[model samples]
Target: MQLSFLNLASNNLSGKVPDCWARWPYIVGVNLGNNHFTRILQTSMSSLPLLEMLNLRNNSFSGNLPSFLKNGSSLVSLDLGENQFSGMIPSWVGQSLSNLKILVLRSNKFSGPIPHQICNMSVLQILDLAHNELTGYVPKCVNHLSAMLVINNSLESYIYFPVSGGQLLVEPLLLKERVYDYSSNLGLITSIDFSNNELSGEIPTELTGLKRLHFLNLSNNHFIGQIPQNIGNMESLETMDFSRNHLTGTQIQSFEASSFVGNYDLYGPPLNNSCSSNSSSNKEEVHHVKGINWFFVSMAFGFIVGFWAVVGPLLYSSSWRYAYFQFIDRMWYKLQYRCYW
Candidate 1:
C-alpha cells in the first residue's frame, strides 16, 4: 500500500480522506481531482517522502494552502486548481520545491502579488496559475526559469519558448524541453507568455536581453505606453502578439499588422497613420518644404529688382539719348515743309 500508485480521478468520493493514504512512503502518483472530498488535505500527505505527482483539483478546500508541500523535497508535479484557496502565495514555494517541475493552480480564488522568490526554482519546467484573482506586476524573476514551459494554463494563444533543439508548441510556453533526452538537451532557452491578467504598467525593456527568445505574448492586459523600439532587434523572433492593450506609437516595420491589433492608440501601415507622432512628422515635412519655397522665391525677386535698379540709368543715358536726337531732327524738317514760310 505504501509503495503503490493511487489514481482516483473523476470519482464521486466524499467525506474525509483516510489518513492511511498519507503515510505511504513510495507513492509515485496520486489523482484525486474532480471529487467531493470536503476536508482539508492531510498534513501527513505532505510528509510522504517519495510522492512525485498529486492532483486535488475541483474541490471545496478553503483557507490558506498547506505549508507542508513546501517542504516536500521529492514532489515534481502538483495540481490544485479550481479551489477556494486564498491569501498571498507563499514565498517559500520556489525555495522549497527545488525539484518540482510542473505546478498548476488556475481558476482559484487566490489573490495578491506573485512572490519574487518564484525565480528560485532552477529546475521548474511548467507553471500555470491562470483565471485566478491574483493582481500586480508579473514577477520579473519569472524570466529566470530557463526551462519553464507554460504560464497561467493558457496554451492556445501563448508563445512557447523552448531550449535548444526543443519542439515548438502552440500552447502558452507549452513547448517541451528535452532535458532528459541527451540529443535534444542543447541548453538553449527561449519563450515567455503572460496574457489576460490584471498586469499593468510598461513592458520591461530588459526583456530584450533574452537573445535566444523566438516567441513572446503579452496581450489582453492593462499594459500601456510606447512599444520599446528595441523589440524589433530580436532577430530570432518569428512570432509576436501584443494586441488588446493601451500601447501607442508607430508600428515597427519589422513587425506585421498581426503583431499589434485592438490597441486603439497604435497606428501606421495596414491602418491610417493616425498616431499623433506620425502625423506630426508629416506636418513638419510640409512646413519645411513651404519654408524652402518661400526663401527661393524671395531671393529671385530681390535679384531681378536689384539688377534693373543698378543698370537702368546707364541704359537710358547712352542708348536713349541718340534716339531722342534723331526724333527731334525729323520733327524740325517736317515742321519747315508744312509751314512753307
Candidate 2:
C-alpha cells in the first residue's frame, strides 16, 4: 500500500509506538499525537528513509529523547511537543536535521540549557520549544533561522504559508534555494519566548544584536538587575514584555509603561535635581548652627552660678562669712546704745 498520509490523532492507543510503520517506504507523513503511548520513542523510526513529516505530540513518552534521526536526511518537519520527555535536547538534532524546516518540542518537561549547536541547522524555518523547564541564556545561533514562525510554548496558534500546488513537489533545488534564502537573511530571526521559567541573571546584552527581533518575553522569572539599555537598538522589535521580574533603573524612553509593569524597583526617566551642592556651603551652615547653640548654653550656665553665690548668705546664716558677721554685730550694738540714751 502506497500510503501518502496517515493520521491517528486523539486515539486511545496505549503502550509504545509500534515500529512496523517504518516498513512503508512511501509514507510521506505520519501523526500519532494525543495518545496514551508510554515510554520513549523507539530509535527505529530513523530507518524510514523517505519520511518527510512526523508528529508524536501529547503522549506519555518519558526519559531522554532518542537521537533516532541523527542520520535521517529527508525529514523536513518534526513535532514532539507535549510529551513527558526529559533531559537536554540531543546535540545530533541540529547536526542531522540539516534539511529540517520546522521543529517543535514545546510543553514538554525537558530541562537544561538550549544547545549552541542548533546554529548548524541552516535550513530551519520554524522552531518552537516554549513552556518547558529549559533555562540559561538563549543560544546566539538562533539568529540563523530566518523563516521561523509561531515560536511559542502554547501551540494553539500557528503561521501557515500556503503552497501553490496544494502540495509541495519536494524538489532538491527548491529546497536548497529555500535554505539559501533562509541563511542569507540570517539576521532576520524568530521570536524567543523563554518567559515563565526559572531563568535568572541580567538580560544578555548580546541579544540586542538580533536586528530583526519582533517578539521578546522574559516575564515571570528570577531575572534580576536592570533591563539592558541597549534594547532600544533593536529597531525591528515590535513587542517586548519583561514584567514580573527584578529589573531596576530607568529603561529607554521608547518602551511603553506596560512593558515594565511588574518590576517594582524600576523608575522612569532621569532626575534633574542637582546632587552637587557645594561641600563648603553645607559645612559652614552646620558650623554656624552649632556655635549659636553653644553660646546660649554658656550664658545660661553663668547666670545660674552668679545668682546662687549672691543669694546663698541671706538664705542661710551658716553661709555668712567673717566680714558679713562682724558688720551685723556692730549694727546690733549701736541700736542697743541708742535705745538706752
lDDT of 1 by residue, 1-341 (tens): 44556767788898766777556776666778888887765467877777666778887767787776876787766778777778778888888887766576765777787788877776564466655666787666565765542223234322222211223211123322211222222123244555556667777775554444655667677788888777765656655678788888866766677667878778888655677865586689889999999999999999999998866765768766677678889999999989996
- Give Cα-based local distance difference scores for all models: 0.66, 0.66
Worst 10 residues of 2 by lDDT: 170-179
Counting clashing residue pairs in each candidate, in order, gives 7, 1
Query: RMSDs, each prediction?
Result: 20.7, 18.0
lDDT of 2 by residue, 1-341 (tens): 76666778788998977777656767767778888889655556777777777778888888887677675787876778778888988787888887776677766887888787776776564456666787786676665654442233232222221222234322111110122233323223455566666677788776676555566777777778878767777766766778788877766566666666666566654322122333344467789999999999999999999998877775766547666778889999999999999
User: Candidate 2 at 261: error in angstroms?
Assistant: 3.4
